[model samples]
Target: MTELRHRGPAETDLQAADDFRGLDKDGAPDGDAHSDSEAKGDTGLPDVPVPPDDTPQVLNKALSGLSSRWKNWWVRGILTLAMISFFFFIIYLGPMVLMMIVLCVQIKCFQEIITIGYSVYHSYHLPWFRTLSWYFLLCVNYFFYGETVTDYFFTLVQREEPLRILSKYHRFISFALYLTGFCMFVLSLVKKHYRLQFYMFGWTHVTLLIVVTQSHLIIHNLFEGMIWFIVPISCVICNDIMAYMFGFFFGRTPLIKLSPKKTWEGFVGGFFSTVVFGILLSYVMAGYRYFVCPVEFNSDSNSFTVDCQPSELFQLQEYPLPAVLQSLTGWATVHMYPFQIHSIALSAFASIVGPFGGFFASGFKRAFKIKDFANTIPGHGGIMDRFDCQYLMATFVNVYIASFIRGPNPSKVIQQLLALRLDQQLQIFNSLKAHLTERGLLPANEVAA
Candidate 1:
């Protein structure tokens, strides 16, 4: 009896030790075997979602014979070529069309992002949320485009009494409209859903900041010169393409945790390729009056025109090579447009820093467990996906111009002077004439007049 009792207690002690170690009585894992494998496989990051097959039936049928991987490649390639072709067509259509396209794209991108918020928060049934979001969009657009119209089309605004009045009170009107939306939002807030409603309120404003504000800057860049808009944008596109090609073929090492597929090899290749592309693209565009000239509104024609003498930056100038480069290349001087040097700066930013915008969008989508912002574009995702980097580039170009490139615009000053009362205009004219005469710049006869 004593021997049996000792063995029983000893066995109980062993059983308790096994339980402490998370093992069953049989000396195996206590839980599901698959759960152990899952713990082993946990990466502390979300799995990258596979893109859905949203291609058209016709294209789908054509690609049906191929494997899924090859089919995706072909679909992306064809759509990419088509988008590029359409882009060229719009550029040919002129600035007005381009501005309209930008507006449309802004609206579409806003919708895609807002729709995602709706899905994530289950706010479809929420009162006044969607309406207020769009109201805010309208209010912001009015404020931005209103300022643009006043700045660029001031002559037209002056001729129309209503537009003139609106231009003068644009800011006040924008604020009033936004205030009305705010009041409505407060009224719409529910007791149980207060937190979610506030979350969505923040989401809407951030979306506006991202979409509308950057787009406004893009329009400003366009007005400076189409080159300001196009070159930066093309640099981003070129970098995107080159990086993808290099990564697809040569990438072995990962570059970032946010985007697993990105690689250092692709990043380096894209940088060099984009720099060369920017230089050549700038060379071609610099030679053209249409591409280099600032967009202006002609009062007589009542339409926009881009016709100005090529700026010195566009003209070819001889630059002396550094001693190191001179000896290596057997060249004393190199003839190139000054703008090409600027292009190197733009291209470097586009290639090196621009990808972060895309990475940010990636993180956002991952947080929401979404594959893409929307299925608006087959094989490419949404308009936001394509233009995320472009928006960042636009802001950079705008700041660059204001800081380094923009000078006193004589014509703009003249337009502002013309908009003043007759007496005020005369006062300014007299002041300028007096200053110029003192400096011996005004002719003797003209100064007397």
Candidate 2:
């Protein structure tokens, strides 16, 4: 009776379970299951776990025989030349293209930095972090570019009713948008991840400040003249190349602990090279009206124009040499554009202080234990790596122009007048007419009319 009970329903149910799992009562897979697992080679990772490098196959084949160090050098050198060629192409295309390139670079750089921040605190799985970061970027860009459009292309904005309204209330709208993002971030904070969320929030803001603000300044420099944009940028690039050349061969004494590869030899060589380069480049660019003239909008033609009388700075001038230089050169005076003198300051800063920006970036990478920001560029690391110094140089150039070069912009003043109500415009005109009349600058007939 006991044997019958054991062999009845209980034994049948156990057999059914084993059959469903494709295993016998001994808990071993059948022949089919074993063969399938074997065929799959279950290594617990994808076949190609990491993506292949996107380097050109021709270059890779050509460089396959070289040592790793030499290969890296050749790759970087070739790519640098390619980038310069592309840059020249864009410049030929026009300022609009250059501005577009700057905008694209700014977006890429922001992406790289924000990605690093995300990875750093990815363990917490913070919600709305990326969304909020991008939201803030859009808000900041809207505020800045809106101001630029309103200032430079006032006629275009004034003609479009919606744009005119938006231009009038741009700042308020930007603030409101930012406040919404801020509130979203505050609400997304979780109890356990409070510190991490705020850290990322601060991280996002700092990245925006560094990337967005400086790039806007670059556009501002571009509007002033192509020379202002080109000279400073070229100086930074030239200094970087010259310094690298000097350091690579003669880098015996280290310049800074943050970047051990940097050498004092490179620093000095780059400074003199950059200063000379700046002067020569500025001289050449100053002679060309297209390069020297401020970019302006034409309401009549509905296009941008760079046709203006050359400013005194762009004209040839003779200045007496200092006693020390006069004695050295045996000349009382030298002919040069005044803008060349300003180039000295621009180049000096690019070579001297611009490198510290790279060092700061180096320190940042070290803190995060990263070799480079990203692998976007095979030998150059990333766009941000190349531009770390350029942004700093842009800030310095903008400030230099503001402090010494720029005065009140008459076009901007006129634009402001045009944006005002007719009555307000008439009031300003009357006030100006009275003031000029008092100074005997206004004709009696014009004043009466």
Candidate 3:
């Protein structure tokens, strides 16, 4: 509650503002330059000073001044912490529940992405359309992640030995959820102002978003521990910060045509900085040597270990090794060059993809010809503006790791958790699941087995 309140006037419920069209105070046409107050009736209310449609770059030179770099870093810090904390909490909370919460955030974000353009390019009872479309997008987002969630549920059910009977019944279960959702999309067509474009395009984005984001989480969880799940999120936020820090402090070179306020100096600075920090983090975690053993490779036999205790188990003391080891594990080493190599690889991919997502959002704003996604944040723009990099980066990380390397799984985790009782051991599984839930890990409901 304190955290909610601390956000202040900048903290209007974006869900509430989803339908908002950002009208001016006189309640007149945004394009109309004149007002009735000038000619005749003057109300007691003071006129709200609307910023000009043609805003000059560096709207506040003082704000954007080198001295103001600290201010930019400050805002960046808050946003970075917010994104990190939110990602950390959500990833463990329970995948279905985290996704549902993401559904609402996505609605706000996707709506702002479209409406920033709407605000500048077109006009009507836009507030109504914006609001209606927001709920419509909410449904679309709900359907998108809901599809994943529902599919995941059936996938779980279908995996069971008993439920394997439903294997032939897969289509009956899987397709049904989306079919029902598609019908809901059809029902929304009653709002004549809404074109199928909104529903189709909107659903497309939400679906891609879930696939991309979920893959990122799964990949990170595979190799590194929970902290690496924030890799993409941290990179995106750091990109914003170091870019701001460099742009505000030493912004001499403009990078490209998309965002002129952004500088090359800032972009490179943030990119390398994030990689440095991320690799450092990876190295630090490596010190604890979380995984007890390495994936065994038999050089002489050219075969893999048959740890058929379960192929799922990552570690087995019984697995043989020659004096010349295949890989390193709990026997910790600084191993900076190799670890840094991995971090750089991951961060470089993210840095490029992250900014592309931002440019995508910026171009989106241009298509709408709007200034900011929405005035949800005073210095920042909208939730989408903030999360755009994160959205794209998550997808990128997922694809990258999936294409390159496979990470550890829970059976291996279970092997490690064996230090505890079978009952206590299962709590480790609970922790893994907490990643996808909403309650944000409520101490395991009294540590049930």
lDDT of 1 by residue, 156-254 (tens): 898889999998899999999999989999999876556556777998999999999999999999988899988999999999999988887889989
Question: Would you give me the overall lDDT of model 1?
Answer: 0.84
Pairs of colliding residues, candidate 1: none
| Residue-level error in angstroms, candidate 2, position 294 | 1.5
Candidate 3 local lDDT, 1-449, one digit each (tens): 23323433223233112213333344554235223423432322112223343322444443455455465455545555766687667755633344356556655666654443343213223233344444444444444433432232333433356645444444565466556555655554433334322533454455445433444344333333333444555666766777777777788999876687888888888888888777766555444323212223233564422122321222222334433453644332333434345567767866666788788777655433455666565456667677777666666666665565445555445334654578886776676667634465545554452
The models' CA-based lDDT, in order, is: 0.84, 0.84, 0.50
**What is candidate 2's lDDT per residue for 1-33, written digit by digit as tens?**
233235434353344345335574467774445
Residue 222 CA displacement from its true place in model 3, Å: 7.9
Pairing residues by index, what is the TM-score of model 1? 0.85
**Each candidate's TM vs. the true structure?**
0.85, 0.85, 0.52
Candidate 2, clashing residue pairs? none
For model 3, the run of ten residues with the poorest summed lDDT? 306-315
Q: What is the lDDT, from 0 to 100, of the residue 14 in candidate 2?
A: 47
Which 10 consecutive residues of model 2 have the lowest summed lDDT? 42-51
